[model samples]
Target: MTISATIDGQLVQWRDSKRYLWLMGAIIPLIPMAMWGLYALTGSTLSWYFGPFFVYVLIPTFDLLAGLDPNNPPEELIEAIEEDRYYRWVTYAFLPLQLVGLIWGAYLLGGGTLPGIEDPLTVVQKIGLATGLGMVAGIGINTAHELGHKKEHMERWFARVALAQTFYGHFYIEHNRGHHVRVATPEDPASSRLGETLWEFLPRTVSGSFKSAWGLEKKRLNRLGKGPVTLKNDLFNAWSFSVVLWGGLMIAFGWEILPYLVIQAVLGIFLLESVNYLEHYGMKRQRLESGRYERVSPAHSWNSNNIGTNVLLYHLQRHSDHHANPTRRYQALRDFKEAPVLPTGYAGMMVLTWIPQVWRKVMDKKVLDHYDGDVSLANVHPRTAHKYGASLEGAAA
Candidate 1:
């Protein structure tokens, strides 16, 4: 069924199919619920691990089989799509479910009265459950990323609330203030360098991001003549909330729950870093003689038009457009023909990164090709410059 309406002096037809596309993101939350249901029915540990298995295994296979989505909405319909509240509501409605799944996973692993796992969860089961649930919580970060860019106050606050679930509240500050400004440069910890494996990138990103968040907050306070210790620091406010929430969970559940929360939060942060690593790996904005990098363009990021993951991640695969226009709504983000394209959706790419040799083999040539074999244009890792014959002396710092 299709509904037609007039807007901006143009006739807009909304088909039922197009109307419900945002519901695709609900798959992230549903995976955990399905895993728990299966575990309850069969009393199998395999069921508890099924969520991550489905995400990393089956989803990528299906995406490969389904192929890409080359279609884009007509230019006239973009305004209507951006204005549609259905897409935003789909994200908001899932926020509470993310928390519920986190709590559910905690209860099961923390030796609560959950029926699905009667025996005390083993160390391996706890880790497996935490990792599985962490991926689900990553959806909250994705939603937060979308909402944090909005101009509305409530949406921004809700984004922080979602971030607190994974104890990743500082992402709200660092990403917008630090990452966006320094993206595709050596100054941005979130942007992965060429030949940097996940192992090397994770430590730098995890530690550098928190430090960057603090520095960004301090700079903001200094500009306003407010001290660093004041409440005006959004990082302080957000992380304080996370600390209190984690403390409260410990009290409500048990000491055992502390490790569960910590482990899951680590996984959630890793999930974020993994996406960050892929978004601009080995891509750099050119530095003009004026001593400033050129404006970020579509060519600075990797884009994937894989239909399955695009819907699953709320069009994050069209990253080139998102970075180029930070305020553009997800539904309105466009794919650029000039942007470097990923060979597959993020899911498959993430799995490949687990084997560093495979990841380097596949991505190194692509990165070199993007710069037309000029290694200097790529963001070469400082230690690995010898491998690429790239000089960092004139590179944008």
Candidate 2:
């Protein structure tokens, strides 16, 4: 579908026009963390569940904003997605609050093994904290994820600090330099191989992500010929600092804290991988005779139009365009017609993903038979648009 370029005497993209959306994208994570802080005073069960759900299901969804495209958006009710996205940039305002929540949570929890395991109150507290810590991770880890890919260096630094919360220090290197370049292809270790279930996708994504991050650092070091020390090597520094800080924090707080911290890391990464799973699913690229892949297009990634997911995550559901133009920012990424479309948005799919058999059945055929393009570089690609209810695919070209 072609779009009208001229509006108000300017070629404004609908996605770019909605810069205000970005403001919502930026700081929503703090809402739950703040609630968790208030809950800290009460230690109520409702607070525990609400905190984890908001962090895991809520904040990460803010990422959808990063994938908005102005060419096609959710009808005229929302105009100028790009302008709306400019607002999302404001999310950094809550960064300090997120930090406070994490430190406070760490203070309340941390340490090797908990003593007095027989105490009911302590057991409940431990479980609650386990989930709450994951929520804490959602704040730091996911928040950094949104900023890490930006062209701005200060934004990238903010992302690094967020990664430090989960002790996943190498995300800046692995994600920007590694994942973006290799996504939707076998070259990207983060992309799930054919027939690989999400269960299997988990280990490969986590381990591969860390390894890639380290390798990124090594490549830089080799150019400079410096050891894996010095502040320049952020990953190494983060790893060392994380181990010491987490351990020291645990010792200082009490044994109850360590399990929760580790759990948070696992949960946050798991959420990250889940997004990875949805981003590529069955999409792939074309390999040219030169032994390099063809230029990326929006058709190379999967798209989901589910309004709930789109509204929540800031349009990250439109992933294909983001990968095609990594620096375009969420505002400029177009919601192209070539990408494959998902039946549901992220929230529903996230629920479906939990049941492997169902998720496989639901997604496999849609990916296999529906869309087609130059996939020798990697396999299936689909398109999704929020404005249309229809799910369409282009048979292999």
Q: Pick the candidate with the highest TM-score.
A: 1
TM-score to native of every candidate shown: 0.93, 0.75
Candidate 2, 22-88: lDDT as tens digits = 4554444444455455555665655645655664465336435444333454433233433444344
Tens-digit lDDT string for candidate 1 (1-397): 4445676888877443434756867777666678767878987777768767877887788779878875666666777767778778987877777777776776766676556656777787677788787888776788899999998898898898788878889899899988899999988999999989999999999899999999988998899998889888888789886887677667767777777788777877777889999999999988899999999999999999887787778889899888988888887788889999998999889998889999999999999999999999888887788888877673434
lDDT of 2: 0.61
Number of colliding residue pairs in each model: 0, 52
List candidate 1 stretches off by more than 4 Å. 1-19, 394-397
TM-score of 2: 0.75
Q: Which ten residues in a row have the lowest lDDT in candidate 2?
A: 380-389
Candidate 2: residue 279 lDDT (0-100): 76
